[model samples]
Structures are given as structure tokens and as C-alpha cells.
Target: MSKHFWQTVGLGTIAGFRSMTAPALLTGNLAKFHPQALAGSPLRYLQKPLVATGFKLLAGGELVGDKLPQTPNRIAPPVLLGRLLSGALVGATLYKINHGKTLNGALLGSAVAGLATFGSFWLRKKTTDESGLPSALVGGLEDILVLSSGLALSKGTDIGAPAGRAL
Candidate 1:
């Protein structure tokens, strides 16, 4: 309906491909470069009180629910988690930013997410593929997009003119 709407769509499409990195770039960049644009999005969750505690748990390598099996274990769980994280987070982010009212935020977040995926995929090709870094990075980025976009959209403003139309 609007130019911003189209932009959001583009972002959502990209975000579908890869979730984590897109949001990370946006969030991290905003935090460092565009503080003015920073709002109540999920990106701000990084600084929350409970989140700080959760971070410590993650940093400590502690698994939630159940302890992870050592070696000779199925890789399905981790793989599934990664994929789910990517999709769900990205979707949620889009929804959040949209403020549960529009597809605008989701679309924008998706586009951003897609860019991150493309870049990460490209980089993985150059790596030794020995480490699981690629997948992990993808997952994390997806989470960021989903959370940030969703939150941002929750209170977003429709700005600018529609596409393919004269101002």
C-alpha cells in the first residue's frame, strides 16, 4: 500500500533465507551508528536484566531442559533447532515490528534477514567447514531479526511515499 510497505516486504523475503545475521547487522549497526532509530525492539533485549542472566547461562555452555549427549549423538536436534530458530525468530521479528497489525515490519525484517543469510552462506564457502560457526551464526542472526523487527514494528510509523508513484 505504501513505499515503506514494499520495503518491509523486501526485507522479510531476505530474512526468510537467513534470520540471525540480518538483525544483528541492523541492531548492532543501529546501536553504534543510528542510536536515534533504536526503539523498543527486541534488539534492546540484549541489555535487559533477565537477559543478562540468560547470557551467562549460555556463556557457561549449559543446556536447558536436558543435558546434551557427548559424542556419537544424533545431529538432528541441533540442526532442527537451527532451522526452527531461523524461521521462528525471523517470523516473530516481522510480526513484532508490524505491531500485530501489518505485514510491513515482517517484510522489512525479512529483507534484512535475507542479506545476512546470503553473506553468511557466501563466507561459509571459504571456511574449512570444520566448525559449526556457520549454522550458529545463521541461527543467532535469525533470532535478532525476528525479535527486533517484531518489536520495532509494534510501534512503527508509516513513512514516505508509495513505490511506482510520483511524490
Candidate 2:
């Protein structure tokens, strides 16, 4: 797979943690730095400032909602589906900007999201159950990680690589 494939995986992983966050960061970055990447494509709407702001609001709400007691499991069918779609959008948009096949990006993004959904859920559950830490606190920490990583990945920063290297 190409570097874009790995990028989709990174974005999808963030979607698994917070369904709207990947798109939030992705759209914001696109709107600010790659407006022309989606020219002539339906996805270009995502580059609009309003659309990016909307996504950011939704992502913030999701982060807060995740800490609520009534929040459903991330693996729930409806919730999981949303996360998958979020990842798909992130992947497709990245691919479009990078001159890759959108469908391929969507597939990789959604697949990683599905896996990360369960993986993050299990990891969070185990840590909470074992360490006696509050789920809300753990989730807050996750929110930090998601935001930091999402920003970097969306900005084409390669993980584990030299500072100047990017995808």
C-alpha cells in the first residue's frame, strides 16, 4: 500500500476514538491549506469554512458526549456505522487531494475504523477496570491524543519519522 493508505489508517484510528473528530481535523486542514484539492468534486463542499466549523463542533460534542453515562458503546451498530463513515470520508478526501483512488481510501479508512472501534473500546475498558481510573479521565486523555495525532496526520506529518518527513 502507498503512504496514503497508511494515512487513512491513521485518520480511521482517530475516528474510532471519536467518530466526528477525524473529519473535523481533516476538513479544517483542507479548508485552510488545500482548498483546490477537491475542486470540481462533490467533496469540495467539505472545504468550505462553514462545513469545517460544523464538523469541529460535532467532534467537540462527541468528545464530551463520550464521557456521559448514557453514552452507548462505540461498537454499537449505529455508532460504529457512523465512525466507519467518518473514517471513509477522511480517507476519501485525503485520497482525492493526493491523487489516489477515493474508493480505495474509503475502504482502508473504514476497515481501520472498524478494528480500532473494538480495539479502543477493549483497551479503554480494560484500563478502567484494572487501574481504577475514571473512564471520563481516561477518555479525556484519549481526546488529547486524538486531537494531537489527528492534527499532525491531517497535516501530512509522518508518525515515527524525522520531523521534516511527511506523507
List the global CA lDDT of all models: 0.39, 0.81
Model 2 has an lDDT value of 0.81
The residue-by-residue lDDT of candidate 1 on 54-111, one tens digit each, is 5335423422211233411112355334433443443444344334433435444444
* Estimated TM-score for each candidate: 0.30, 0.88
RMSD of each: 10.4, 4.1
Model 2 CA deviation exceeding 4 Å by range: 35-37, 155-167
lDDT of 2 by residue, 1-167 (tens): 66766878898999888999888877777666644557799988987889989999999899899999999999999999999998888888777777778898788889999999999999999989998999999898888888888877766643212122232
Q: Which regions of candidate 1 fall more than 4 Å away from where they truly are?
A: 1-19, 29-43, 46-75, 101-167
- In model 1, state the lDDT of residue 142: 43
